[model samples]
Target: MKKFILIVVFSFILAGIFTFINQPQAETVNRPSDKETSNLFESLQNELYEIYDIGAFKTASNPNYTINEIIIPINGSQEYYDSVKDEVESLVKNIIKTTSFKNYSVIVEKNKLDQFFNEKAKDEMDLRYEITKTVHDSLYEAYQNQIGDIGITDSAQQLIIEVNTFFNGQESNDFFKEMENKLNIIFQEKLSSNLLVKESSITIHIYNKYGERIN
Candidate 1:
């Protein structure tokens, strides 16, 4: 029927207009409408974004690892810590044993980093002490400065810089506690799935409200 053909042509025209109108808008929005936060998981991530304001925004839907460096509290377990301790220590020792200053590294360290961490120079426990010190230094900086607060990117920028420094070890511990409260389910699932790095250690750096490091 001629009427049927006319109806089909009109429908096609409507679709064409929608496609045209959305094309330019699509290019400008680096993200998507789905990127908006609604689920509890995304809401949680958004909270971190609000507080620390570090990494890019990811909805609960995006499981892509490169966009996310660390997940909170889920990785903050003592049992999890124990399982990975030997693994991390062994990796550190092997790297130091095989590599030298000429290795051309990224994490800047002016001191004799290799010799300081050499297994020949220090025993297993001592290596732990050294590693903890390094983690503490980095974690302290992150906590205080919020230098790279995972998904956080707006508020607490100035305050976190100061807070991460002044918060004592006790406070660092408490922060981990809160973090665990928020992301424990994800942390547990990741650990069970063995989704984290083989050589990494997820540490809990506690601090006092005063910004001093706690135990």
Candidate 2:
């Protein structure tokens, strides 16, 4: 009878072990791989590029980062910004939802574009200064050859053209006026083409990768 009881107890233990082994394991959430995240970012960026009103967009992402960064540069007016703000927000949110990121942000800077363009503008400004100087020198040479002795000095905003009062026994204020006008025209024409010129201003927008403005 004891042997029968022992056999029954052993069978019970084995049944319990089998039941435990057959039970389902807890499920785990699958996170996106680095390549997958990169693909998602590029896809979203391409969509953003297709938007007519958006001038430019940049994306930054990392698995360890809780929030992603996206910068969009805008050159539109306040009216334009108001019009497209909602649409941009909606589009970004939808794109983010398609990804594994649970939290993210979008940034829209007022007038910040790529660094390359900014550097180019600075280089152009320097070129403008050099070109303007050359034009002045050329004009000075022409004056000396035709009108007589003169002195040219560079000042902060104006070029001082000093004429000898006794040059060829005549004072020519007309020549100075002509030189000044010519220089002004050249400066205006060249500087107008500059993107950094304040006379023509552009607006920039900033946002996070999730499409929220940074304020």
Candidate 3:
């Protein structure tokens, strides 16, 4: 009975050792460090700069690091960007393949710098308009008596000032010119005084009492 018990105990110990050895181990995920990520960003940017005028580097990634998105802003016209978009995408894909994230689904997108800047300038001008509302209102009030209904609009990189005069008939070209010069000076002076106002060209449009554009 003692010999049989000893055999069974040895067999049980062997089974436990085999089970522990064969059990699958948890995967050790090597998440990228901050320094590593920065290096990768620099490397990708440098590669892109070699072929095109890059605006800025933009990237998005999830915690799992399975999906990565890179938005590359190219400084050129729409035609040029569209022509080279496929090439840019292929270049980016090839470069990414050499990295440890070879299996990651990399999505690349290209944007035109002109469109981006235009949109950004408009947004900035809108913000400035909101910030300098008091100044605008004061200027309008000061000029409303002289230049019958005055309307001001901020468009991209220009400040459009529309003046509807209370003149009985069509005004002379010289008259409109003089009015434009005067309003330009006043508007520039008042707007320039405010630091929030960006450097923008002023356009003056004059309309007669009959709603006909005089200038």
Top candidate (lDDT): 3
Q: Give the alpha carbon lDDT tens digit for every residue of 1-215 in model 3.
A: 99999999999999999999999974333555677668767887788887786677666666765555666666666677778777877777787676654544455445555677878888867756653464346545655644455666767767676667666555567876766676666656666654334566767677778887788
Off by over 4 Å in 1: 1-121, 145-165, 168-205, 209-215
Could you give candidate 1's per-residue lDDT for residues 61-106 as a string of tens digits?
A: 2343223111222122345445544443343233334322112121
Give the lowest summed-lDDT range of ten residues in model 3: 130-139
Error of 3 at 210 (Å): 40
| C-alpha lDDT (0 to 100) for residue 202 of candidate 1 | 43
**TM of each candidate vs. truth:** 0.18, 0.37, 0.41
Against the true structure, what is every candidate's RMSD? Answer: 26.1, 17.7, 11.3
Candidate 3 stretches greater than 4 Å from native? 1-30, 112-114, 119-215
| Candidate 2 vs 3: which has more lDDT | 3
The residue ranges of model 2 lying beyond 4 angstroms of the native Cα positions read: 1-31, 53-64, 68-86, 110-130, 133-215
